[model samples]
Target: MRNIPTRHTAGRTIGGAVAALSLITLTACGGDSGSESTGAAEKLGENEGEVSILAWPGYVEDGSTDPEVDWVSGFEKETGCQVTSKVYGTSDEAFNLAKSGEYDVVAASGDLTLRMIAAGQAAEVNTDLIPNYEGIYDFLKDREWNTVDEKNYGIPHGYGANLLMYNTKDVTPAPTSWKAVFEDAPKHKGQVTAYDSPIYIADAAVYLMAHQPDLGIENPYSLDEKQLAAAVDLLKAQRTSVGEYWSDYTKTQASFETGDTVVGTTWQVIANLIDPKKAPVEAILPSEGATGWNDTWMISSKSKSPNCAYAWLNHISDPEVNAQATEYFGEAPNSDKACEFASEGHCETFHAGDEEYAKKIWFWNTPINDCLDGRTDVECTDYQDWTKAWAEIKG
Candidate 1:
């Protein structure tokens, strides 16, 4: 949901190491090397008897959240790898916490994955080692966001789009574009809300890309200073109408139900949690496209329990486990077979196999000086710049 800042923002480090990596039945294409532990473990050595995980809420459940929702217990019984978990609210917090070397694995959203790679916090994943890897959706594998130069980093967990949601009664005419929250923001005045993170800047950039073609913004995350300034300006104006900015998932839903927020950005999960009886609402992906996230379970490069980490990866990727996690988290699962394990029509609800539908959503990616949109001529503002700009906008 957020990323990159000043304090620990060190320059990228280069390393060399090819590990014996395989995905499902694929042959090992790389060899193990020291100094750089390829994100994969060479063999399923003995389970370390325990593993620690850093994940988003609802990803790793031992039924503590809901006794009926415990999947971690089954994994532990089968593999003898006890699990200890810490949940993070934002991608930025996950990225920072992963650096502390306390967790063996992390469920990283797309926005923070590459930054983790650049910082050497993530290892190259060898998919062959994962027994359930073959069942993953073909569309999620070997993609630029989770792979580097043809090597996989980790297994994709799930994905969903950030949709426009509004009070069905208060907001007339059923809004269909992000303009309701940007250009027409004043209309909602003090009743509008937005995701509270620097990443929300990309929402403005998405709006500008459609309305201001002269800005030449190809990718929301690849904005240069001029383009970023334009986005920031738009946000500064919209800030005037915003009732609150949300990062805490529960707070977002509570604000909507209480009528403090009438319109703004939201995830399908939050929309589901809101009681329609209390506040009738509707959500949709606007014509201008929307920002979204694709999360992956990446093992920590410094993990002392590689075997247990790999075991956890495989266990979570299993169709049943995948189904439990994705459904609870309110997103599409990464494994194609997970649908069979989901509730009736759950897969259809998220458009799990509709590649065409996915094309309309721009998944989050960390902003860097080297433009991801492929423009070398103009130097783009990095995440640190976004952090500084965000502070100014919030002020």
Candidate 2:
């Protein structure tokens, strides 16, 4: 049976105050702010009998939330690793919690993975020890966010796109592009919604990359001042039409149901939750492509249960387990095999294992002064800039 629709908060923005403080701290100490952790394990040892996990809500279910929704119990029963899991509301919170060295493992979104690695919170993951890792999609392996300098840092979990969701009865001709929310937003004035976060700036950047080739925007997350300004302009214009900018899933669902929102950016899970009888809606990955997130399960650098951590990683990656966890959280499973174990039509709904579709997504990444797109000549805007810009755009 499908689990209840719980909002999965992985890639949402870190609060402005927290972001400003983090940026100041990173700058004061330079980018290399934390000690590097020891390398990946060369061999496994006996189970440590316990493991603590920091993860997004619903990612590490032990039936505490709902008796029928759980995958952790089996892992504990089989591996003898009593699981204690904490759910984090955002990547920044996960980063702070993981740094406490209180977690043996962390399910990190791309935006938080590199930060964790930089802060000495993530240990290199030895995929050889995770046999199920071989089954994960190739496109997900060694990505910029989860890997640094060709060394893996974590196992791929699941992913989902920030899709364009619109009221079917209200939207005409079946919108296939993000233009509906950008240039055409005025048509749905006072009814269009958008994600409320700085990372969402990347969505505008993605739209710009396709419509304005002269911007030379190779990566949405790596925008220079001019490119960022162009995106900011687009967003500022869009803000005029936006009914509400949302970080809460239930609010978006309710808005759509009540006809307060006719068109806007949304997640597939929210689309699933809307009562079709109240408001007909459809969510699609627009033709211009989209921004999304791929979360990873990383072993903690200061893990007190390294053996159990490895066991938990491998256990969770098993196709059936991965399916249960990802489906519950409403995202594409990481591997083709995992799709088979997912509920009927779930894989198709999320486009699991579709490498071509995956290519169109620029997964969430922490914007830094050093361009993620590899342009050394010009400095790109960092998360701090994005944070400040987001406030300006929203205002």
Candidate 3:
């Protein structure tokens, strides 16, 4: 989510095929922080030759005139590697593109990372190659989505929560529950919008998990027929109140600008940076508790240039790189040193260096039920099953 796309807010950049919009909310303002000292970045080693990257649109600076906000040139300059980038709207698209064996690395979200690893499209990361990797937090290092056993697959990236952001000017008291976009949305009638991605079906799943705890909806990704039915039912009700499904940042920003929807579930990064010239909106972390996500760099297992890829990962997650990403993306940095280079107030505003808040954030861990915590009876749903439930909800 953070800067990786959608800042994990409502799975904004998960790809239109999977969710709704292609969110690139990871700019300095896209999150809570903006600029930092890459002086240390100069110390990180260089990348050799050209590294092809399949990236989400806003992951790196796009040669925009805004030098104040650029990651590519700096990266290339620091690494000494030439760069060629192709932008895709969804993880599915990136996966398909990456599957072609064209790129060296991918900035994958939790939902898609495991699939990439399983397919052997991404190689397991050798921590020895990435000296800075030791800085990654322990919990993230071995998770259902990234690693198997003690092996690592990719580097820690950015993370953020899916908050219930809305046009407070229109929503009156504002919303405190997922029901605002589920069962209760109808009262608002044509003023509701849910995430526009297939994986977003998980948002509905998360709601059911909290509100219908009895369902034992432990893992949104792994739903049984009964749990799937409930999630779909809730979504169908939400769809009725929905005016439109959004998967593009420009579209959501525009929708809010036109006052098409008063309130809806959204990402913090996108919600915070909505083009104010277009609309006045506010983001709220609702009380029923909310679901969130994270984005990370998953290396291609078959990458011809694992060296360059590792180099890229090391450079990106370096404290300075991580800090820059956090400031621009408005999410928490996964790097310990990166926070030191972050803007003065960024630690508070974006949770940049706050371990306490970081602990509280339910960064979207790819849902698995073996139980991921340890259980004999439940196994998580595979992508195909989640895919099916997603389609049913859309229907």
Question: Each candidate's root-mean-square deviation in Å?
Answer: 7.4, 6.7, 9.6
Q: After superposition, how far is residue 146 of candidate 3 from its true place, in Å?
A: 1.6
Better of 1 and 3 by lDDT: 1
lDDT of each candidate versus the true structure: 0.80, 0.82, 0.63
Cα lDDT tens digits, model 2, 284-388, are: 888888889898999988899999999999988999999998898889998999988899999998989876677677788777766655567997887768879
Better of 1 and 2 by lDDT: 2
For model 3, the superposed segments whose C-alpha errors exceed 4 Å read 2-48, 275-278, 353-362, 365-375, 378-380
Model 3 lDDT at residue 322: 76
Greater-TM-score candidate between 1 and 3: 1
lDDT by residue (tens digit), candidate 1, 325-385? 8999999988668999999988888888677777777777667666666666887877778
Estimate TM-scores for all models.
0.90, 0.88, 0.82
- Residue 281 of model 1: what lDDT? 91
Candidate 3, residue 118: CA error in Å? Answer: 0.9
Sort the candidates on lDDT, descending order.
Answer: 2, 1, 3
